[model samples]
Target: MNRSEALSIVEPHLTKERFEHTVRVADTALTLAGLYGESQKKVEIASIFHDYAKYRPLDEMERWITTSYLPKDLLSYHHELWHGPVGSLLIDQEHGIKDEEIKSAVYCHTTGKANMSKLDMIVFVADYIEPGRDFPGLNEVRDMAEKDLLKTAWMVSRNTINYLIHKQTSIYPDTFHAYNDLTKQLYGGN
Candidate 1:
């Protein structure tokens, strides 16, 4: 689907604030894609639909899982990370999005997986660096994005892992695996 059509599918599901954030992320992703030589169309589509399941109620998310064919381990992760995969399924089954890159980006946007595609990195970092996000250290990540997309993704993964540890939250193994993989890629396996 085109950008406008993709936006329409997600607009009805997201709150006004989230819709605006998605728009900003799409713009950011496109710019990043241009700089990093990734596919602009994939970046735009993935960014637009990244949070498609964000506003869905917990029960609804759970129900969607019941019908999903995702692995059992993924279903056990109850945090916001689960929304990425769930959103991907919703976009494919409900909205008829068939692009593998777009679906993969959405599926792995939250807790990134090892060896992520360029499109995945774009969407993931775009969401974190979107203008509307004002969390501490975001500016640093923003700068890192401009200077080095892979480095910024690595930093974001590290920060996310640290944050979850600080909160005493259950850490998804995929997140740790992603962080390690990126760290290895960036720091020559330390």
Candidate 2:
């Protein structure tokens, strides 16, 4: 589906505030994609659907997990990271989005994984730095997004790890892998 059609499908599921945030993320992703020479269409689609499953009731998310046969690691990280994969499932089953890049972007937007695609990075960082987000260090991330996409992604991965650590939450292993992989790529395997 196209961007407008995808947005329509997700709009009813999100609160008005969240819908607005999605729009902001789409715009941000497009801008960042242009700067990074990534596919703007993929960035737009990924950003639009990044949070599609975020507003589902906790019980419904759990139900999806139970019935979808999602991996055990996902269940282990459910409290923190279930939404992304669940969102991917919802998009596929409900929205008929069969594109691998789109599905992968939605699947990994939360608790990013190793060897992320360009669209994945765009969606992940766009969600984090969207206009509605007001966290410390966001400015640095925004600047990095404008100047260097890989650098911005690496910073976001580090920030996510730090936040999880500070909260004393169990860090998802995929997040650590993502950080390591991106850091190595940005540093030329150093």
Candidate 3:
């Protein structure tokens, strides 16, 4: 579907602020796609739908988690990371987006997994560095994103882990795995 169609599907599922943020992320993902020579259509689709389940009722998200057969242990982590993976399933089943690449990019956007695709990196970093986002050290992350998307992805992965640790919250295993793989690539260690 086109941008408006995609947004229309998700618009009722998000708050006004989140809808605006989603649009910014889609725009940023398109920019990154242009910069990194990835598929703009896939990136845009994934970006717009990345948080499709973000505002779902907790019970609804839990039901999706179980029905989709995602790791039950996900329940233990903060709910902030649930939307990406759950939204993947929601978009595919409810919105007719079956392309595995787009689904995977949406799935990996929150707490990136190991072996992310170029499209995945674009959605992931765009979600983090979207112009509507503001956080400590955001400028540095945004700068890193502009310079190198993959390295910026690794930076976001590492930074997310640090943030979770600082908050004394559980860090998802996929996040640590991504951090290790990206670190090995960026720092040259096995």
Candidate 4:
């Protein structure tokens, strides 16, 4: 599906606020993609579908996690994280979006993974720093996003890790992997 088509498909499932957030994320992703010389279409599609399943019922999300063969450990964490992987799967299985890059961007947008590409980083950072989002330290990341994609991505990843730790929430392993990978990219690889 194309951009408008994808937006219509997912928009019905989201609340008004979430739909607006998705639009902001898509806009932010397009900006980041332009800065990084990535594909605008891919980033737009990935950002649009990144939260396609955000409002899905928890039981339905659990079903998607179980039947889709997603890691069982996902359920051990907050169910809030389920939409990323499950939405990616649904966007592929149901919406006919087979691009692995788009799918991976949606999959890892929440708790990013190791070895993400430029599109993935753009989508992830865009979602976090989208204008609708206002959190402590976000201005720093947004400023960094303007100048350095890698630094912005790393800041967002580390921010998530630190927030979860402070909340005593179960930390997803992919978050750490993404943090470490981006750390090496920003500093020196070992």
Better of 1 and 4 by TM-score: 4
Task: Assess the local accuracy of residue 103 in candidate 4 as a C-alpha lDDT between 0 and 100.
Answer: 93
Off by over 4 Å in 4: none
What is candidate 2's local distance difference test score? 0.86
Per-candidate TM vs. native? 0.94, 0.93, 0.96, 0.97
**TM-score, cand. 2:** 0.93
Which has the better lDDT: candidate 1, or candidate 2? Answer: 1
| Candidate 3 structure lDDT | 0.89
**Residue by residue across 1-190, what tens digits does model 3's lDDT show?**
9999999988998999999999999999999999899988898899999999988888888888877777888888888878888888888889789999999998888889888889988998999998887889889989988789879999899899999899998888999988888888788778
Better of 1 and 3 by TM-score: 3
lDDT of 2 by residue, 45-116 (tens): 778998898988888988898887677666676465888888988888887888889889999888788999
Error (Å) of candidate 2 at residue 111 is: 1.1
Q: Model 4, residue 46: displacement in angstroms?
A: 0.3
RMSD of each: 1.4, 1.6, 1.1, 1.0
TM-score between model 3 and native: 0.96
Across residues 1-190, which tens digit of lDDT does each residue of candidate 4 receive? 5778978998999999999999999999999999999999999999999999999999999998988768989989888899999999998889788999999999999999999999999999999999999889999999999999998989999999999999988898999999999999889867
In the range 13-108, model 1's lDDT, one tens digit per residue, is 998999999999999999999999998877888899999999888888877777768655766776576789888888888878888889999988
TM-score-sorted candidate list, best first: 4, 3, 1, 2
